[model samples]
Target: MLVINALLRGGIPFIIMGGIALLLNYQEKYSDAKSTFFASLIVFFVGAATVIYNIDHWSLTKQSVVHFLIMLITVYPILLLSGWFTIASVFDALKVFLVFVLVGVILWIVMFILAKVFSW
Candidate 1:
């Protein structure tokens, strides 16, 4: 179950990133699927490590929108580090940022609905 959550949390974002990258490729190709996938894997590792390094401090006993949003935002820069860390301009970065944000919104909705249905 833990492993699945880890995968979904990262995998869903990767799908979002890849899909957005494909769509946003209209303007000079900000990033590619390969880079997006690689970056998302890095994000998974980084996020997991952050929690595992101090498990007691970060248990998910309670879910809060603020914490979830902050974590989602944290992932954006990590994705940028892997995908657009070089000569990408702010506009290009913003494009990726917006993509993740849209995905984040969708993810939040899914999570909320799941919680409601499952009484989590």
Candidate 2:
């Protein structure tokens, strides 16, 4: 199925990245079971969410907007749970949102250029 394929493609990387993040943040204190559980949950949603791209009728902009929103909605909470940031005020949340959006835009541009260059 397309859904399964999408999950496998995106979910695997998502889970892998979770592991990498755990390793990278070695100095931080994270309960192994809790972290693994959260990582699995996050990866499952992220991977499953990628199936939105298969909606051929949707414009690229629409698909992208939906996907970006899904990522932001899903990933941000998990990042917070993982102790990545402590937001004490609305400004903190806005700062994080802006940074996330900025990084997403930069990555999108890079990928667009790479796709054009490779004729993808």
Candidate 3:
């Protein structure tokens, strides 16, 4: 579903932002839930707009990669800001890496199902 895809693309960064806020005890400084929801909405609109704009101009493969990359680029900063890669232990980074992989897998599965259903 569109909602699922949007969540898949934006959920990690949103979570990271929330985690960082919690870790820094800065929950009051930022409206984490509102900001995350808005970010996800932006991502979803960007994706839908991209698809609509490219409907007659791009292949599915190209669109998929572009969309994925766009989502990744949009979220990478949150990962860094969340201290996801600067943990004191290797296991911590690995845990984050696993979560990233899991997210990717879920995104792929959803996209695959969508593709099949839409015959893309």
Candidate 4:
């Protein structure tokens, strides 16, 4: 039941990312099989991590923090190794990290607002 729900949740992003990876490969943007594999894996982690939100007992803050940590640990390395983003210096790495955080916050806010409006 729960497992099936989680699988369904994760499967969408997995398929989407797989397609994107294939497209990138076809276009010769990132032809490395290893990079494609890692890119797909990153999306899997991201999609699966959404299960955290289903934890009703957890506060929103707790859920967001846990999800953020999960993504940072699981997705950051793959993005770097897959040639999605290059960080030639510490400053560049910091800039990338900041941009990641900013995007996450903006997306979170948008989703939160949509959820509230829809629930109302």
Candidate 5:
């Protein structure tokens, strides 16, 4: 069936990338990985339905919207799996990353002040 083919066309890559990421960096402790994978699955169902219903007809020059949607479907699962597999929960990881950013900014400011004070 055409529908099944289209679903697979988008799904195979999503599953491969998601599965690989899950294997490589997956944390069995936190629920983030499972949640992300499930969310992506939901998105796939919705997106597939939208595609089947002829609702994705947005023009962008020569770029095919269907292809763009397929890419998103393919990429987001991998991204979620990779991004959420850390030991920390996704929220905690974001907070930790933010703290590091702040620390870097503070160091940069201190260096800038010292450079100005030393005229170098």
Candidate 6:
């Protein structure tokens, strides 16, 4: 879950998809340990960068356009890596977009519920 969130926030789904492709292409030559370690490191850096950026840019008031723009910037690479640029890949793009939206909604709902329950 953290990895997925990190990938979403970092706009680095291509890195993850590429790593998966590499693993599948050379499963016999590469050990799971190496792949996992490298992937974890990449995710760590990406997640850290996202946190830093958010911390520096956060504002009390909401701006829908800014939020949308940030989301678009984060999602473009993932869309490209998922092959969403081709006519045949329109469904793929929709799927990825839905998944992202669903995950975000779920996270928000969970946070809201938890806050209510805990009085936070």
lDDT of 6 at 33: 38
lDDT string for model 3 (1-120, tens) is: 645655655565656655655644455644564455445444544444344223557777776677667655655434534542676667765666567657766977896788789984
Off by over 4 Å in 4: 1-3, 23-40
Model 6 stretches astray by more than 4 angstroms: 1-71, 79-87
Structural similarity to truth (TM-score) of each candidate: 0.44, 0.67, 0.44, 0.76, 0.32, 0.39
- Model 6 global lDDT (CA atoms, 0 to 1): 0.52
Evaluate all candidate structures by whole-model CA lDDT and list the values in order.
Answer: 0.60, 0.73, 0.56, 0.78, 0.52, 0.52
Candidate 6 global Cα RMSD: 8.0
On residues 13-116, what C-alpha lDDT tens digit does candidate 4 reach at each position?
Answer: 77877787787777878666456667678768777888888889999999999999988987766666666677798887777778778988998899899989
State the lDDT at 12 in candidate 3: 54
**Candidate 6 steric clashes:** 0
Model 1, span 1-120: residue lDDT tens = 555665666666766666766666655556565565556565664444333322445545333444455565667667677645442689878787777778766866786688689974
User: Could you give candidate 2's per-residue lDDT for residues 6-56 as a string of tens digits?
Assistant: 779767876776676677568465566456657666677767776776788
Candidate 2: 10-residue stretch with minimal lDDT: 27-36
Q: Largest TM-score belongs to which candidate?
A: 4
Q: For model 5, how does the per-residue alpha-carbon lDDT over 14-56 read when each residue is reduced to its tens digit?
A: 6864674476445563455565565556445544533443333
Which 10-residue window in model 1 sums to the lowest lDDT?
Answer: 46-55
Deviation in angstroms for 69 in model 1?
Answer: 5.4
lDDT of 1 at 119: 77
| Candidate 2 root-mean-square deviation in Å | 4.3
Q: List the residue pairs that clash in candidate 5.
A: none
Candidate 5 wrongly placed segments (more than 4 Å): 9-13, 55-120
